[model samples]
Target: MEEPGPVHCLLFAEVTPPLIDSHCHLDAAEFDADRAAVAAAAVAAGLATIVIPAIERANFGAVASVCREFPGCVPAYGIHPMYVDRAEPADLDALRATLAREPAVAVGEIGLDRFVEPRDDGRQAFYFVEQLKIARDLGLPVILHVRRAIDPILKQLRRIGVAGGIAHAFNGSRQQADEFIKLGFVLGFGGAMTYPRAARIRELAATLPLEAIVLETDAPDIPPAWRVGARNAPDQLPRIAAELAALRNLPVADIITATTSNVCRALPRLAH
Candidate 1:
């Protein structure tokens, strides 16, 4: 008899292989209580890797430390838009200097966020454009944090070109999705797709070419529907991938294979 593959997906009867949580914050305080155990459990849950991106100057060291502490975690460095208000010019210098020293898989968890009130569009644009340039200059892929600012984020990505990367938790239109693809980027779909009410996201996941899609947990955020209103983690990635597989009417194995490939292509350094 053929050996049964790993069974991590609740609804995806198709066997699964090791998965990659393309975006997660394993360094977040939510896991500080038992971060090591969480990392071990995620590996046991069938997750082979987790990409952790730093949100600000403060956590740069912490993110890097997490990577050293856990073989399964990789790091990305950048300034998140939500933190630009408290950021200083010197921080950009710090980011550049840090990237010089660290082996980051990408430069990110960075981009525009129109969702916040009292929006400082100029400051946001400045930090975003600058960070994009740093990523470009470093020849590193970027992990974008695009919210209601997709078009604007796309515009800047076009202006300040960098190696292709993942558009984390992408919730844009199919047209926008195509635009990202044209630029050699992959769309990340996660916990949001698990919600039946997220019709638009479901439709995109169902219809987009699998080559253009990647899996992510956006952990400690974007909790899946089954685990709604609860803390999300890297271990939730398999079920999250299963949701996408179900959305596309494909087997979990196919989703796992294609998405894992997509992520490696998006962030080449992570492939190793």
Candidate 2:
């Protein structure tokens, strides 16, 4: 009798779900020269989705255009807190009008920032609140750009009431993380967690419920340790995911499945 052929094991097969780069600024000028190449590299590197957020009203068209060129990229429209100084009252109206016309995945790159000095707190609040109201009115989720202001961010969220979104590059305390989760928000983890000195962030990455965490690159910034001092991109997300798996002592496959699904949870429109 002929020997039986070898049997393949499905149990140990790789669970390489499309890795999601929940946040990336692929439309930034740094990528202007090779943007198409960068997008292709992301796909080849296993990144199935990359959410590009606009930082200012002027770039809204540019960001949307970039997303349109890549099947894997999604556009998020909003004025970042850092750019609130240049924002005019009319821009808020423009944002509202734009949201109604565009297929925006979320109102994003929006939130508080206490880290920068000489900022107009009131102006930042105005844009943030107004944008939050727009997001609520449109029944869309937001992509928060929180920095040294989690409590205030949570406060505004409670006041304006958005449809829940991702807290991009979350660097808050455990209590803050819990609050965000309670409000139906998912925390994005990226290059920061790759730093050995970022003990608190790494701990949160390891201990937080997998369902509450999503992977990101925040590209053109937040480069991983190995790529430190270099321009970051969506291609770095898979390695970042591996770092998270190592931190949690879980298989990378599980991290891929959970984080990929987590992004869809935070931005439900992406589900389509």
Candidate 3:
């Protein structure tokens, strides 16, 4: 009986469930020096999966290579809007062929970006529409990189509907959030939501139905408040999850479970 007392403690030991970094540029140049260590750290930090998206046709090989090195890492192949200037029409064909040849989860890091200066609206539209068509034809979801262009993104989505995907680093209004969710998309919330001044984003994170929200780091990009101006990584996700839990006034475990399920539902291939 005396020894039996300590055994009960084992049953109650706190265990954190695995998390998914829905979007992370682990293959980006920022990680070139320590990619292997970063991947290992993510696993040790309890990351079950990390989705790495390609920004252009040239990097498709890089993305695939990263995924090959890290089994837990998955790839989403697409030409990002920012890089569309350098993209040739033939790259679209390459994108199509690559998606067919590779185990790509989605056509992404794709969408509009009005924030950039001296951009060709027509060029962005051309690439966006073509990529949307590719996603539609391939019957794959897309990972959107929307910036001041959610409405246009929604318009095209309505026109050439594809399988639902995640709106990475979503900073749209509640109405926009509803629209994406209605279209079978889950909005990604990450480092931006952790900031006190990101009120609109924080409000959305707290108020949006848990099922419509997914977690992402957008690593080497949107670093959390504590790590602002530093290189972000997938290992920061658990803390991001905790921030979401605090925002929603729910337990961290609940946030993790709901967001993980949301991601799987958004990208069904990841469930495998």
Worst 10 residues of 2 by lDDT: 4-13
**Ten-residue region with minimum lDDT total, candidate 3:** 3-12
Worst-scoring 10-residue span by lDDT in model 1: 4-13
Clashing pairs in 1: none
Candidate 1 per-residue C-alpha lDDT over 20-127 given as tens digits, one digit per residue, 9 for 90 to 100? 888999899998898988888787788877889999999999999998888767788999999999999999999988887777788988999999998898999999
* Regions of model 3 farther than 4 Å from truth: 1-16
What lDDT score goes with residue 248 in model 1? 80
Which of the numbered candidates is closest to the native, going by highest lDDT?
Answer: 3
lDDT of 3 at 78: 96
Candidate 3 is scored at a TM of 0.94
C-alpha RMSD between model 1 and the true structure: 6.9
lDDT of 2 by residue, 10-45 (tens): 111222677888899999999989998998788778
- Go through the candidates in order and give each one's C-alpha lDDT: 0.86, 0.87, 0.89
* By lDDT: ranked, best first: 3, 2, 1
| RMSD values, in order shown | 6.9, 9.3, 8.8
lDDT measured at residue 43 in model 3 versus the true structure, 0 to 100: 78
Models ranked on TM-score: 3, 2, 1
